[model samples]
Target: MAKITFIEHNGTEHVVEVANGLTVMEAARDNNVPGIEADCGGACACSTCHVYLHPDWVEKVPAKDAMEEDMLDFAYQPDEVRSRLTCQIKVTDDLDGLIVQLPEKQI
Candidate 1:
């Protein structure tokens, strides 16, 4: 299992043990993390699950696909250099300690 830390806008943090092949959105939703609404599930159709990967950890994550990038344009917050849609981030052994910070809002 990979351990992913999700930091909410209020500074609250939620850590979940996610299985390989599971998306970060799945882990957060299953663990009841509040900020990730995952409105379109894991289909990459909505940016409600947008997250900002910690800068130090960005290099460890994979680059976003065109579909994910397009969806992120609709997010309430603009995509920063570290921005990513949690639904597109699949958990892997290499992402064992992945940390993602939530944006101020996701509407």
Candidate 2:
């Protein structure tokens, strides 16, 4: 399992242990971490689960695919470098201590 940390725009943080084969979005939803709306569940159909990766982890996580890149356009105040859809990130041992920050609001 990976210990992921979800940080709100206001700095509130929710840390949870997520098992492998699950997406980071699942961790947030299951743990009731505020800010990740996950409006489309894990289907990648919406940008409500948008988040910003901690600088230290920018290259550690998987790269975005064409679909995820496109979906990010709909996220609120997306940062070209840090924005990512939590659903697109799967949990793994490598992601232990993963940290992400939510946007001020989801779009």
RMSD of each: 0.9, 0.5
Task: State the lDDT of candidate 1 residue by residue for 1-107, as single tens digits.
Answer: 89999999999999889999999999999999998999998898888999999998888899988898888889877655788999999899999989999999897
| Residue clash pairs of candidate 1 | none
Against the correct fold, how does model 2 do in TM-score?
A: 0.98
What's the lDDT for candidate 2?
0.95
Estimate every model's Cα lDDT from 0 to 1. Answer: 0.90, 0.95
What is the lDDT for 8 in model 1? 95
True-structure lDDT of candidate 1: 0.90
Q: Put down candidate 2 lDDT per residue, 1-107, tens digits, no spaces.
A: 99999999999989999999999999999999999999999999999999999999999999999999999999999999999999999999999999999999998
Candidate 2 regions with alpha-carbon error over 4 angstroms: none
Error of 1 at 53 (Å): 0.3
Question: What TM-score does each of the candidates earn?
Answer: 0.95, 0.98
| Cα misplacement distance, residue 103 of candidate 1 (Å) | 1.1
Clash pairs for candidate 2: none
